[model samples]
Target: MSQPDSVTFADIEVAAKRLAGIAHHTPVITSRTINQHTGSQVFFKCKNFQRTGSFKFRGAYNALAQLRLEQQQTGAIAYSSGNHAQAVALAGQLLNIPTTIVMPEDAPTVKQAATRGYGAEVILYNRSETNREELAQTLAQQRNLTIIPPYDHPHIIAAQGTAAKELIKEVGELDLLLVCCGGGGLLSGSAIASQTLSPKCKVIGVEPERADDATRSFHSKILYSVNNPDTIADGARTPSLGKITFPLVLDYVDNMVTVSEEAIIRTMFFLWQRLKIVVEPTGVLAAAALLEGVVKAPQAKIGVVISGGNVDLKGLGHKIMNYEL
Candidate 1:
């Protein structure tokens, strides 16, 4: 197990305090139907209802809120497919810090519009032709802007851990906790929180099967990566875990699993109908794992983190119309 002494429960507490009154203490909901189907006491931590419609707001706000005056004046740059872009943009707006985001040209139109709506200047690039990180770094240097990385930063990870902290505080200890894995920020962060608050809980990270880099890395205990996987879950389309997140995930997370694209879409639609919540495909990955029996723990207490709900309705309608599941 590789441990970097990275994020800790104490850090999450600090972030929670920082985010208090500013960030919504998102609610946790339960489903009797889901509980009956899984035969477990299921708790759904709904980050979808958070500001910017995702949990990314916690990290983005925490990181930006703690910036030095100079950094705030110079502003910051971030590169994200969707959620992080909107998060940073909104956070920057709240903190009066200018933000520039490098996003894929094909990123969800809703996300792109939200980022711009938050007042950040968005630079779109072809994912096949350009590396967003390098572009952000170059822009950062040229503009004297800070690079607020989407994940892998200690502040970001600690900030993200606050979601699981809130969940555990609300629901008490759990037997199993399932988290959606993107670049491993939320996964690793949630595991860290579960470790301290619910020592007996087993934390598992779930991803889309088409973008299973984290799963591969977890099983082999070796860093693995993908190159712009074509999964409908845009958030999980990250190439791989980061230097910070990879080690944190290897050390803290108990297991990793991946669900099919069909499972993801099916779960999203199911949640919309059953829970009456609009969960994006990426947001429902952890729920899919539990609902579809990809990772089962019969009769045990379970917690599933719904990461976000920023769906492109038009695109999702097309996907739903075409999907058999």
Candidate 2:
């Protein structure tokens, strides 16, 4: 199938088939404690159990798998703060394609090590000083590598939708579906899937208060970008949504909400303590919104996408032990 700028529910279905047997059908988890606290029935789509420890693997693998044989032979390139880097690297290794990733120098050490451990050449740059996209493009051209962006492409969006598709399939139907938004890929994709599979579901995107470009854009109906925001949710520190994802979000997403950094940390701790799941900060965006009652639909059936589990264990432990954000 030829790639398009925008993705559809059919495209997401095709991606699901393509990923069959390759990607894990991650579990849908529930916490009675959480339900009691929020006064809602919540199902958590645990993408943290996904390969490469994040939902990013779904998109990365799908994109790379569709490349021309010649392109695969040449290699693939990507830029990410952490999870996407590891996703692309692991996908390339599985497909016997050389992969190169550009990551911020100050990215979580565990993520950096995991990306390199997946057999990809890791290039670190100062995020504040260098533009990662431009650097990745230059390297891709020089090395004849195909660029598989983190969340800007059709394949990525479609593949990411499979998470919600699986969630809805497992849980029947939901009144609301909450997703963590970074570049809007997962939110857009999930919106499309929910529109098809559960038309009554109101899709909501959640982000850190610091990285509220998506929230602003959703409200204003105009795309906006923000510089690097200092938030503990490193996975969601994206500057803005991409061209491909923006329109889908605007049309299909019902609402957008922002959670404070403290709310995010508190949610993460709750997940670890009550749910027995170690979700990263970004993964807790949706849960934070629900727990904080930022967007309330009392007694509603809700689905929350736990995006990833790539936490820096030592750092997270320290923060939790000391009640630090």
* Winner by TM-score: 1
Write candidate 2's Cα lDDT for 203-322 as tens digits: 999999999999999999899999988888999999999988888898889999999888999888889999998899999999899988898878999999999999998766665564
- Best by lDDT, which number? 1
Q: Tens-digit lDDT track for model 1 on 77-157?
A: 999998999999999999999999999999989999999999999999999999999999999999999999998898899
TM-score to native of every candidate shown = 0.98, 0.97
How does each model score on lDDT?
0.94, 0.93
Clashing pairs in 2: none
The C-alpha local distance difference test score for the whole of candidate 2 amounts to 0.93
Global lDDT for candidate 1?
Answer: 0.94
Give the Å error, residue 132, model 2. Answer: 0.2
